[model samples]
Target: MLWPYQVKTVPSLPEDAVRLDVVEQRIVPPEEDVVLIAHRQRIVRGLRALFAAGVAALGLLVTIQVVMIVEDRSRVQPGLVMMAIFWLVALVVGYDAAKGMLKPLPRGKWSELVAVPASGLATLGCRIQWPDGRWSDALLSKVDPALAANVFGTQRLWIVGEAFRGATTFAGVPGHAVLGRVRFN
Candidate 1:
């Protein structure tokens, strides 16, 4: 008799026996929700980005208009200068809106593994890992060290990064865990 770890069993069958295969791990309900969570996150992130860009651009435009009005102007009339600034602002706002609409938001949230999947091996669309139990969800395809420089920056990591991390770590979907423990096929 071999030890349990070393033992192997063959199911009883006909002369041309067909072996029975058992799956040790199967995807739980939450794991299935990962796709949905990813989609939602993507949408939220896109909206957040659009809002940020719009606010920043508006602030900059207002500042420029004030500076132009206060400072001495030679050739360009204040009204023309203001119109030019407004046009520039409009272009920026339109561009930002387009970009926001095009970009997808990925879902993300803060919670313990117990809230989602605790500990289980999971496969990413690409191989990625959480070394320090910390991960960023960033829109950028390439993970930039600069983006992770501060707590705020890392906290607001992009949608893509968040989705990827959420799928793996189960840190997404406000109430429901995106996954419980993922197993590869």
Candidate 2:
């Protein structure tokens, strides 16, 4: 994708920052988050119901479409094949969305992390951080240059996304996109 003129590396301030609580890198199952276990389970139960409703609606649509295409034909039609592919993709998405319905639990140890600031490397656009000795990354937005320059160094950033929505990633986060972005913190 091409960025328009004036694409920037840093953002403006507190207004643009996403306040992320420093969480421990541990494999926390939905049940482990004791505080919200019941809430999360309830959501999952509701999503399961939604999944059933979606399947019913999509199934009906697919059935009618298939009948219309094959009613007077000796062989399957292009529309039928297209509908097949569409349902296939939909099922895949539905499966993944189900998995994402549950939040992810990150597991591991965090190293000095100081090296992340020292060595600047970009992966698929997001900055990579060194966890202990291995490389790791997250769905993070661009950090303000001023914040990064301070002693804390990139303690915060801004990102737009939905948590527990992606099949595998848990969160479907977008890239670090911004406009002129020179407002006060």
Candidate 3:
């Protein structure tokens, strides 16, 4: 399963800044089908739907309360104010959830791989430097902890977008084609 990806150099970075032997390469998947990719996408959609429903329900309830307060006292009441505050909080949360679903992740370009310090853990931090000097730290998710520990800076990687939803790691290197989810927040 070879996935095609577009490769472009950042104009901001000098041509001599870094040398990438292969700008574009065919990405081979570790497995015929990556279940984790689909599962994460489904989770993203489910969360978006849940937040949208919450926003609608809260909006309606707040509207009804405001109308009732206006009819009974002909003025804004403390109860109405409280309801409004709750609605505002719901709206903010819903907005953030939806934004995450809508906004596209920034295109990641593999620049350099930094060595990971020895840690007795299944996951190790992989820091990726972009051409523009921007750095993104991602956790290496491997089926075998031994393989993760052996990953060195010599490994090559290519950046691919939309390969996996909720994925902070976009660069694909050999052996571990798909790194674990990246943490933007």
Candidate 4:
């Protein structure tokens, strides 16, 4: 018989699935709510201010390119390149200002979890099967590089897990998103 080196679990077929009560509370967290946990909160006012500034800056760049085209057509190439680069920078900044993309894991008490990890490469994900036959996929995280390597290594290892979920939502909803913390037993 071939040795099994990986475990993959995807909850398919309604009969095999259980309710996501304790974690998602019968509903998967909204994708937007997940973003709140995953990104820094960007106030709308700041984004509006940035939007105004970006428009003016872009206008200036365009005006300079027009001047170059009239003065020396060939010299306009460098101006065009600069405008492209500036436009890219503006796009990234605008997106970040409008919505956060990088945020640390929120501070909270870790809750003990009984879960069977989805095994593979140095990746963060698992599917936990409840006693009632319900299974749910959770994303895993660990701050320590050493510990994460051990648990995420290629070799098989028994895993004990903890979870830190977002306790609040942007839209004032009661439910939250899950971020699993893991350790090898």
Runs of candidate 2 exceeding 4 Å displacement: 1-32, 65-84, 102-136, 140-185
On residues 47-165, what C-alpha lDDT tens digit does candidate 1 reach at each position? 66866776677677667766766785543356655765776677677665455334433333333221121121232222223445643332222212232221122332222222334
lDDT of 4 by residue, 1-185 (tens): 11358887766756766776564444323343454343223434556577767777777777888887889887777756688578768767767644422333333322223454465433445554444566565544432333334334432222222222332212112132222233222
Candidate with maximal TM-score: 3
Stronger candidate by lDDT (1 vs 3): 3
Model 1: lDDT of residue 27? 31
Tell me the whole-model lDDT of each prediction, alpha carbons only. Answer: 0.40, 0.40, 0.50, 0.44
2 versus 3: better TM-score goes to: 3
Clashing pairs in 2: none
**Per-prediction CA RMSD (Å):** 18.2, 13.0, 15.5, 17.3
The positional error of residue 48 in candidate 3, measured at the CA in angstroms, is 2.3
TM-score of each: 0.27, 0.36, 0.42, 0.32
TM-score of 2: 0.36
Quick one: best lDDT, which candidate?
3
For candidate 2, the lDDT comes to 0.40
Model 3 Cα lDDT, one tens digit per residue, 5-52: 899977597766876587674444433224424533665788778777
What are the per-residue Cα lDDT tens digits for candidate 2 across 53-168?
Answer: 76776687677767866785565566656765676678678777466444432332111222133332221222333333444433322333332333134443222121121212
Clashing pairs in 3: 168-182
